[model samples]
Target: MVVMGSGGHTTEMLRITKHLNKERYTPRVYIVSSTDTTTISRVLAGEDSSGTYTICKIPRSREVKQSYLTSIFTTALSTVSSFPVVLWHRPQLVLCNGPGVCIPICAVVFLAKALFLIDARIVFVESLCRVKSFSLTGKILMFFADKILVQWPDLCKVSKRADYIGRL
Candidate 1:
């Protein structure tokens, strides 16, 4: 199962799923966020849908910016909601694209003893001369992920847990 922050990432993830060998692997997508209207409309809903995909909206207002009060409230609520979703799906493996949306859900998967794969790559290294705040999520991911994959070797350098998986 694949879980992520938003529809754009979901679209990219679906592209990755397209490469999987269907005979060996069946793909199911789960979107974890406050809402995924675009993903639900474009991918999760349709006559072609087989109900293989599901969406779980964490109970939080749609505010991208972080605040101490909102973070505590949302995190608590989302953490509470994550269990039933994990129990319902019981996926053998869970893949995550780095974001706050996946945090509580990944915790659920870990608590359920499911394997986790985290997509973590360092970006803007040359342009910005450093990894950004986005890359900090990689550190959090490394703590839980069974396998932490990085597109660049530079990212591997920062995270002791990462394996060089080639450029994404």
Candidate 2:
């Protein structure tokens, strides 16, 4: 499963999807925010928009400038809503960048993994903008995600688990 955020996050994921070998990643599942207006169109124009892909929508965990306290509730709501989608797909791997929606999806994946219901590995690709430090989502997911990929080598110093995979 691929979790995408708005604008740049979506663009970056789509770019990666384009280069992926379709045969190896057959019948992909794409998770997107219901509030996002552009992601669908962008995915339609993307190379991986073949009949094998399925797009799923979940509510955004937090909106821009929303209070962190309020986000807790919304994030919980998103996690609840994500259970059905995640279970139905039961994807073997989840690729997420720095999207707020990613938190719930990855959480569900982790929870299911803990319960031994499914085995899904998560890979978080830290956004290029986060050079020296990690984003809030990146920091939170550092311990949970199987691996975190960073663009800059210097960023690796911030976390021993993070790998500098160069610019994506």
Per-residue lDDT over 45-144 for candidate 1, one digit per residue giving the tens place of the 0 to 100 score: 3214455456566653234777857687777777788777777766656766555666676666666663333232221111111232225445555656
lDDT of 2 by residue, 1-168 (tens): 999899889878887778888889877888989899999888877744359988899999999999999999999999999999999999899999999999999999999999999998999999988999999999999867999999999999999999998987
Q: How accurate locally is residue 97 in candidate 2, as Cα lDDT from 0 to 100? A: 90
Residue 23 miss distance in model 2 (angstroms) = 1.3
Segments of candidate 1 deviating more than 4 angstroms: 45-51, 60-62, 114-134
Best by lDDT: 2
Q: At residue 61, what lDDT does model 2 achieve?
A: 98
| Model 2 alpha-carbon miss at residue 106, Å | 0.5
TM-score per candidate, in order? 0.73, 0.97
C-alpha displacement of 43 in model 2, angstroms? 0.8
